[model samples]
Every structure is written in C-alpha cells, then in structure tokens.
Target chain A: MSPIATAALAKTAPPAPPRRRARSGPPTRRLMAPATLFLLAWMIVPLAMTLYYSVRHYNLMMPELRNFVGATNYKLLLTDPTFWHSLVNTLVLVMACLAITVALGLGLALLFNRTFPGRGVARTLAISPFFVMPVVTGLIWKNMLFHPVYGLLAWLARELGLAPFDWLAQQPMLSIVIMIAWEWTPFALLILLTGLQSLPEDQIEAARLDGAGRWQEFRHIVVPHLGQVLYVVVMLESIFFLTSFAEIYATTSGGPGTATTNLPYYIYQNAFFQYDIGLSSAAAVGAVVLANVFSFFLIRFVAGNLNAGSAR
Target chain B: MAIVELKNVVKNYGGRKAQGPNAVDDFNLTTRDGEFVVLVGPSGCGKTTTMRMIAGLEDLSAGSIRIGGRDVSDVAPRDRDIAMVFQSYALYPHMTVFGNMAFALRLKKLPQAEIEKRVREAARMLDIEHLLERKPRALSGGQRQRVALGRAIVRQPQVFLMDEPLSNLDAKLRVETRAQIIKLHRSLGVTTFYVTHDQVEAMTMGQRIVVMLDGNVQQIATPHELYAQPVNTFVAGFIGTPSMNFLPATVGDDARSLQGEGYRFRAGDARAAGLAGKAGATVLVGVRPEHLKWCGSGDAQAANHLAGKVDVVEPLGSTTMVQVDVGGQRITAQLDSAIAVEMGQPIALTCAADVLHLFDAQTGQALGLPAQA
Candidate 1:
C-alpha cells in the first residue's frame, strides 16, 4: 500500500522494542514556568479579582460578608439616570471633539503644505500642542486662558469694556471640549500632514495639465489621499476622548453638577470617591465595549474605502 | 493648430555660485504649426527644463513664450493649452483609463456626451479602447504610456510636450511605441516638442532635431544634416553611434596628414579651403568608422591612407569593427564582415578626404566643410 508500510515490512523484527527518543532540551514545565508565573501574577490575577468584585456586593464600607449578586451591578449601572447622562455627555464630547479636531487639523495641514514664509516655524508651533502634557493643557486652558475674571479672555473682555462671563460654570462641557480639542488637534495635524506630504506630486501636476482647477484637484486628489489618514486620526481621537479622565479631573473636576461627567470620570467617581468597586468595574467593562464598537465601525469604513480605491 | 515660440527664456536656480550650472540659459526655439521638433542631449543639458518652461510648469526667469501668437509667459499651465506626457506617464493612480483621458474635459465641465466622444476618439487613435475600463496601475507599461498619450490627445492642445516618454519601456517596447508615437504625431498634426537623450529617437522621430549641450543649443537641423555635418566636435561625438574618431594631425603646405607612430594620411584638397592659412598647425581629424575602408580591399595608394596594426576585432553579422593601433593611438574602422583581418595583423585603412572632418585642436571647433547638399 503506502511507502511507510513497505519500509516497516522490510525492517527485520527486533528482539527489544526500538528505543524511544527523549526530548533533549528543557522540559515543558521549565519552558512555560516563567510565562505562566507572569500571566498568573499580572493578567489572570487582576482579571479574576475584577470578576470577583464585579459579581459581589462589594464596597469599602461593607467588606465583612461579600454576597453574590449576579448582574445586579450591571443592572444598576444600566438603569442609573446619572450613568446614562454621563454616557450621553461622553458621546457628545467625543463627537464634538473629533469633528472640531479633524476639521482644524486638516485645515492646518493644508495650510502648512504650501511653501510660505515662516513655514518651518509655523509647522513646529502647530505640532507643539501634541507634546504638551494633557494635564498641563487643561490647566493652561482652565486657569490662564478661559478663567472668567483674570484669564486672557476676561482681560480682553475687560479691555473691550464687555462683561466677563464664567466659562466653566456657564458651559462646562464646552469648556472641556475646547480644551481637549486644543490638545488633540496637533495629533490629527501630524498624521494628516504626513499624508498630504506623501501624496504623489506628479499626479497633481498631471491634473493641472489636464485643466483641473484648484477645487477639482482638492476633491479628486488631495481629499481621496487624505481619507485613510483622516480615519486613523478620528479613530485614535475617539478612543482617547472616550477614556479621557485626567483632563476633566484636572480642569473641571466633573463640576457644574455632572455637566462634564463622562463615562471615565463616572467610573473614577464610583471606584475612588464612592468606593463602589463592583459598579465601577461594570462601568469600565461597558466603556471598553463601547470603544471597541466605535473602533470596529471606523476600521471597517477605512478598510472598505481602501479596498474600493485600490480596486479602481 | 498653433506655432510655439520661446523668446529668450532663462531659468536660474538662485543659490551659491558653485551649486551647479544654470538649469537653462537664455533658450530660444520656434516651432511652426504642425512641426515635430525633438530636443536631445545628455541628462542635465536643460532639454527637459526648456520643455517644462514651454508647458508653463516652470516660470521663465526672463522670457516670453507664445502659443498661437499669444504671449503665454505668465499664463497658468492649464490655460496655455499645452499637454505634456511625462516620463513617468504621470497617470492618475485612482482613475480608470477612460477617466484619465476624460479628466480635463470633465474639469472643464463638458457635457457627458461630448466628453465621451472626445475620449473615445482619442482612445481609438492610440489603440487603447479595449483598456479604457482598466485603471492605470493594472495596465502594462506600454499600455499606460498609450493612455498618457491618449489623455493628451483628448485635450487637443496646441502643442504636445513629451519628456522622454519612451525611456521607461523595454528595448523592444520602446521601438514599437516610438513608431506609434511618431504615427500618432503625424495623424494628430499637432506641433509636438519631444525631449530625449536617445539620439536614435531624435534622429528617427523629429522633423528637426535640436542638439543641446551645457544649457546651450549647439545646432538645430534635420537628422541628416546633424549626422552629416555637426557644427562642432561635441555634436559630432554626441550624435552618432560609435561616434566619429578624432586623431591629432598636422597640416602642411601642400597636403595635410595625421602623423602617428607608424601612420600618416594625406588630407586632400576637399578640406583645403578651411585649412588654407593653417599650415603646420595641430588639428584633429575626425573619421566616421563606416567611412574608413581596409587598404587592400579598396585602393591602397589613396591620398588618405594610414597603416596600422589591428589590435581588436568585433564582428557583427554584417560588418566588423576593427580597432587599429595607429602610431600608438587606437582608431576604429568599420569593414565588411568578409574581410579576413585578424588581430595583431598589420593593415592599412583609407578614408575619403571629402568624408574627413578636420577640427582645430585648441578650440575643438570643426575646421572644414559647408553644409552637406
């Protein structure tokens, strides 16, 4: 039949069974020992702890007898009006921040793409915001810039003889959005600028020779080339905005009575301020799921466009 | 149809004086309506720069360019009504071949039917109708080049500028596409300005060839004129395949002869007028390899006969190129393949004095000759 069977039949019968080969190197236990130890201590242990805390009525105030309360924490989080308001707030802030940042970043990128006087300095200043620490950005915006009476806006208003208004108290969400946009616009600008720079110069020249006006070139060449970079910028900005806690904490402290209380801030409030570990873990998991959903949609859209463009 | 003219066009890159040579210096050319002119030189000789200036892609430092008798020096490239086929093909990567050809018309907001009609006609002319639906990236190199030409044809610009368009193709494809481009130019009857470094292309395609060197036009003439009578040593060496060989010579009272170690050849009365007052002066004698014949096969006692030893022999199917060490200097002679000449054999070669090119050794300027009839 088979070649292996023929080879076996040709071999003489041995008095003793053929010696089995032993593995020469370190055994399975030794090979996996370090990785298993690391996983147990770092990943699995924390995940198990989170799961244990998530399914029990656990709080710092009541730790004597932890009672199993399956789905209670999740139900409470889902039904909580404050939780829903925070989720809406987070969505609005993320959407507003992403839209404003992408628009401003693309505009700046286009502006910097041209050769003009001081272009080098202008580009360096435009990207400087990305290097600023988020907390510092928030502080600078909150105290030195957007502060009602003594900040830059107030000083300008006083000079103009207009009444100064409290920015944070009057519009907490808007204030936070403006601050976040300033910090993230440079990120978008860097990516979009690279995209613009990498675009084929000859194709643009060809379009010009083909009688394409400035607007037509933008629509057909520049915009299509920037599409992928725009997607990446939006996706990354959304993820950062969804999990934004330090900016809000350092600036508004989720003040003005839940006006700036996004999901991450709410989770922070439950875990550290209210000491409701189970509720906070549930909310954290929810945030992760929502981020994944948005990321999935963005990636799918980018992939579809890439495939369509490539196919053409 | 339109005539194109470049008047005193100068392009200078402002920087350190030692940065390099000027890209283009005070260039001028005029192409009559329906004329095919090819600009040819080594790379960095400013041929492409001159074409780009004509296309309005590069602003002239100081000059006026006119198309159809209208000054277009300051006009935008699109408004100049000139289409350029770039060396890279420069096809829009995102568009289909049909779209690439129709882009200019679409930009002009031409109606769909009119755009389609013009695009289809151009595609038919370039024989790329079957590839209209495919994107440029999917097409072969030659196909892509045809698409580029089709794009230009659809515009029907006054002048078509091509910058080494066939250089990217393989050897065989270049030949095939060269013929196609020449035919296309003839059929369109557009004033086409082509820039290339390949002399064969310049010779075969253009009605007139402009030979450029060091940012200056050396000579402008028909292919036959350029090959038969180059204005200077540069043009002579640059234009021909297996370029004309130059040997130092001395002009005497009655006869001019190149005297190397064991070789001396008489320059007869053909070049006597150009060398009248230059007796005993050192000069360069240029002879095309094909013009020289083995002595025994031809007349050995001819006036322009030089004896030498054959150092190398390269036999092509139809001809043999024998490198002869004449007076310690190597000179090439093209002979019939039937010649039974072997390496190291002493031989004698003769050239017609009328075919000999004599040049001043100091200036490297051609000393002899009226333009060939």
Candidate 2:
C-alpha cells in the first residue's frame, strides 16, 4: 500500500493493539519507562507550579500578604478589558496571515513550477526568508522598511511624489501581518510546489489530448491535487500563529495604546510590569485551554480528510 | 475516418550537429482510412516518437504532417482532434467512469444530452456500463483498461493513438483485451496508429507493421511477408517465434552449394540465382525452425542434410523443441512430440531448398528475396 493509504487507514483503525500479541513478547513498557519518566517530570512540573500559582494571591511586590485566592485571579483576568482586546488581536493577526500566505503561497508555487534560466537560484532565494531568525526579521521590517522617515517604502513614496506614510503608527496590526506572511509564505510554497511536481506527467498529456486548455487543466487537476497540503499548511501555521510573541515584542512593544498586544504579550505585561504573578499564570492556563480547543478542530479536520482519502 | 500522413518527419534533440543522433530521423508513413498500423521495435527505436508526432504531442524538427488531409504540423494537440491512450492509462483518479469519458465532449461544448449519449454508448461497447459511477481508484486493472479505451472512443476524434496501452495488463488479460480492441476498431472504423515492441501483438493486431531499429525503419510489410521474406537479418531474428536460425557459410563457385564448419546444404537454381553475383563471397543461410525435418542417421551425409547431437528437448505435449549442438554453434528445431528425441542423441536434419533464405554475410541484407509485388 502507498504511505498515504497506510496513514489514512491507520486513522480508521482502532488504537488498541492486540493484547495477546503484545503480552507474548518482552514487556514493551520497559523500553518506554525512561522516556516516560523524563517527560512526566518535564511537563508535569511546570504545569503543577502554574496550577499552584493560578489559585493563590501571589504578588512579588507584596509577598507578605499572599494567601489562598480561590478563583479571585481568574475572575480578575477574565473581567479585564485589556485581556479581551489582546484576545481579538491574536485572532485577527492569525487569520489575516493565514489567508494571505496560503493564497499567495499557492500562486508563488505555481510560478516556480515552470522551468527557467535561474529556477534553482530563484527557489533558493524564495525560501531564504523562512530561515531568518524571528528577531532579525522583526528588526529588519521595523527599521529598514516600515520606518516612516527614511525607510525603503518612504524613499519609494518620495520618488512617486506621494507623501511618506507611517506604517507602524497608522496600521500596526497590518504591519505585523505582512511581516509574518513574508517569513512564512515560503514554507507554504515549499510544500505546495512539491505536491504540484509529484503529479504524474502523463495525466496532463491525457488532458491536453481530451481538449482541455491551460486554465481548465489547472482548475480541475492542479487545485484538487494540492488539497491535502493546503489543509496541513493551515493547521500547522494556525498552531504557530496563535502564540505569536517575538515579532510583536521586537517591533511594536505592545504599541502606542495596546493596538498590537496579543495574548502572550498581554500576559508578559501582567507578570513583570504589574508583578501580578497569579493573574499571569491564570492567563497562561487560559492560553493552553484555547490551544487545546483549536487542536481539537484541526485533528478532526485532518481525520476527515484521511477518512475520505481511504474511501477512495 | 482518417489518414495520417507523416512526410519525412524529423525530431532532433538540442539541434542536429551536422551528424548528431536523432531521436527520430526522417520517418515517413501514410495510413489509409480505417487502417490499423502498428510501429514495433526494441526500446529507443523511436516508435513512440513517431506516434507522438502524429498526435502533435512532440514537435517535428522538420517536415510536415497531414491528418485527414489538413496540415496539422503547426496545430496544438487539442486542435488536431486526436485522442491518445497512454501506456500508464492516465485516467483522472478523482473522476468517475462517466466523468472521464464525458470530459472530452464537454470540452467541445457539446450538449449535456449528447455527451451522456456518447458516454453511455462507449461504456456499453466496452462492457463498462456498470462501472460508470466508480472512480479509477476503485476499479480493477482490467476495468481501468476499459475505461481508458472508452475515454478515447467517446471522443470520436479524427485519429486514435495508443502508446502500448495494454502493456500494463497481466498476460491473460492482455490476450483477451486484444480481441476486444480489434472488434472495437472494426465497429468504429477509425484510423489508428498503435505502438508496441512485442512481435506477437504486431503480427496479430496490425494490418501492416513498421519494424524499426535505432531511429530508422527496418521494414514495413504485412506479417506474413515479414515472416517468410525478411529484408534483412534483424527482421528475420526479430519476427518469428523461436526466431530464424542463421548459419555462416561460403557460397561455392557453382552458386548452388554452401559449406560451413559442420553443416552442408544445397540451394537449387530458383533460390541460388539471386545469389549468383556473390558466388565467391561468404553468406548466411537462414532457416525457420518449422522448416527443419528429422531424417535417419544413415542418410545424414546426404547433400541436403546437416548432422548434430541433441542438447536439450522441451516437450509441449503436441510438439517439442530440440536444441542441437553442431560443431560449436547451437541450432533449435521444432519436431512432433511423437518423434521422442532424447538429449545427447545424434540427430540428422534436412530441409527443402525452397525454405532456405540467403543473405550477404557482411551487410546482413537478404540475397534471395523475390521483388516486392
């Protein structure tokens, strides 16, 4: 069977291994013991500490008055207006970048699919943005391009006889979205292009023989063939985008008036600036819950695709 | 319905460097309307290139092609009104049988009713009506083969090109589907340009076979003509089952006798007259396995007999193959199973002079073939 079919088939199958067979061999648990113990300590310790802090009135500024809070910190973080604003910002940033990168990534991948004089060099250059460090990418966009006084965009605007527009001040969320897309579109392009290249060449010949023109071939064959990779790109990007922090920190610093503060940056402000450790830990736990909810939908969506793949 | 005319069609890779190798060099063929023409050759013999040129998939380096009396040299594949069945089938994996067969008609902007009518008719003809709702991945290999054939049939194109379409099937299915294809060809009566390297398919399926080797056509003739009177040693060695055996011999001054290392045979005047000009030169005597007969050992020294010891016997119930070792060379001969020839037994073989083929040894060109009628 093909690897795709095997993976898809494995999804529909029950998780439990045959008990008789597993018991017939040396215990499989013995091999898993060391890794399992290490992971337990690694993940469970931080989680237990966070849970401990979330339920108490712990404040580094006034440690003498710390006591059992009993959901007080949860109520405080949930009722705060800044928390709601940051939540919206996170969702908007992730959705905008997701839509832009996937659409443009597919277009760029199709562009690179054709043969050219410098195709190899061009492809290497295209993917170079994805490997840049987040801090460097953030600084480069903020200082060299989005800077209103002497940035590249300002120089170009001056040449066009237009007023120099302030990017970060006027549209902070849009600037962050563009920077993230620039760094991530290459990832989408790499995968979608591989999918396009892997399609059998003969099918295109057959389509031509059947009287299909270029547009019809791409619409009917190319689009549907890229379906799985598109889903995967969206899922993985969503998970990473939900926790976006470094780009916001390095560029906007949570902004002129909290215009670009996302969930992670919001939590950082509460903990270090306000010395509200209990509230920050509660917000961190909320972030984990939100990630779990997104994860549930993503796995269900992928399983649906896999199940349909096996049906074929 | 169409005649495909390829006039000196040439295909060169990276521009011909005065004498660089052509993938296809100066290929020419004209198929009569409704005729079945198959190009057969070993791999890299440019058979597939000739078919692709007819379909307008591969551009010609020079010369021109005319399909149905219209010059199609500069036309796109879709504009040429041709349909191709690829060796890989190339059926759309996501489409059902009806969808695949109906795709071409839809492309031409045909009415939905007419497209349905054509798709159903082709599916019925190919006995794939029940599979109309099934996608390619759900069908068996044989079903997929029929769907590919049905896809081409539904197009009703000016010409049909098949690039070894049946090669993916098992042996049993290959044989059964061949008969079905012949029936479809007659019922449809569309001109077809088929390509394959299998001689058996060439003999059974093609009205005329174009034997090619090394980007050049070796011979183009009917199956019987290719079998009985091959123009050269390559066709002789390539065409028949248990292919024709060749023995190196020098012609005698009288032009009627040949002497080899351990075999001697006589060629009568009717066959030898063609070789009279090369009387003193060396030549090859070719004989088909079925033409060699067993003779008693006492008569082994007769003018027409060659004596050797049997090296292996393969009995096939009704007939047996006997491989004989003569001097240091091996010759295979077919005999009736009742003859009961044993391995390691000495055998005498003889044949009538009419069955022998004489060829110029150095050139490998036939010496005694009657002129083409």
Best by TM-score: 2
DockQ of all candidates, in order? 0.43, 0.42
TM-score of chain A of 1: 0.83
Candidate 1's C-alpha runs over 4 A off are: A1-53, A65-67, A299-312, B15-21, B255-262, B265-270, B297-299, B371-373
User: Each candidate's fnat, in order?
Assistant: 0.63, 0.74
Clashing pairs in 1: B261-B327
- CA error at residue B142 for candidate 2, angstroms: 2.0
Candidate 2 accuracy as TM-score: 0.90
Per-residue lDDT of candidate 1, residues B1-373 (tens digit): 7998888887777644424566887788888899999999999899998998888888777778999999999999989898999999989777789988888888888999999999999888888999998888899999999999999999988999999999999999999999998898888899999999999999999999999988888888999988877878999899887888888888776545555555556765666667877877878888899998877835655777778899999999899999999888888889999998999999998877778787889988777677455
lDDT of each: 0.86, 0.89
* Candidate 1 chain A least-lDDT 10 residues: A17-26
Global Cα lDDT for candidate 2: 0.89
